[model samples]
Target: MKRRTAREKALQALFQIDISSTEPSAAIEHVLEGERSDDYLSKLVNGVIEHLDEIDQLIKAHLEKWSLERLATVDRNLLRIAVFELKYEHDEVPEKVVLDEAIEIAKLYGDDQSSKFINGVLSKVKQHLF
Candidate 1:
């Protein structure tokens, strides 16, 4: 699968796991819809779940007056995946790429203001990280 498709599927799996407390592997399978899973997809979901606490703390740090749990699910998980990639996969993924991907995905799956909100918080997180 393309990286974009992989990111989208990873977000869906993370969403499922967030809402239902489903196992990360099962959530990945559910999103795969029986298609063969890609390495990037598994890497994204597993990486995000494995480091959720640290990711959430990063998000909460960058948020302005908004807590992580209060954010919309799509927005929350989108930020989580982006933050994970930014922090853990920085050697492989560029910061601009992670920020841009999260913004675009937020535009598609998040509320109207989600892209703007995500951009702001992630920019801060990026500044702090890099």
Candidate 2:
């Protein structure tokens, strides 16, 4: 099987966290097992969770009319993963690359407009932060 991207793995872990009220570390451990577990994915999931509050704050700051609570769980987590990569994990991935991957993931797992929503939110974040 082709190796999944870190963003993809992070999305899954965040989805798990959203659905279950589990701790982020526990969720990361659960998701990072079997064939899915890998260094990149583990790092991304951990990194995002490590700075979740900061990432959420950045997301909320740029969200305009939408509250983070109002966003679809998948989209909210997608933005978290993207923002985490953009701000803190810059050494591992480029900003545009992370944003593009987030959009694609949102399209696949999020709502019909998830890609657009993620793009808009991440674009504002990028402008404000970078």
Top-lDDT structure, candidate number: 1
TM-score of structure candidate 1: 0.98
Cα error, candidate 2, residue 110 (Å): 1.0
For candidate 2, write residues 12-39 as lDDT tens digits. Answer: 8888977886777777677667554567
> Which runs of model 1 end up more than 4 angstroms from their true locations?
none
For model 1, residues 68-113, the per-residue Cα lDDT tens digits are 8899999999999999999999999999999999999999999889
Model 1 steric clash pairs: none
lDDT of each: 0.93, 0.81
Candidate 1, which ten residues in sequence have the lowest lDDT sum? Answer: 61-70
lDDT assessment of candidate 2: 0.81
lDDT: worst 10-residue window of model 2: 1-10
Pick by TM-score: which candidate is best?
1
Q: Over all chains combined, what TM-score does candidate 2 have?
A: 0.87
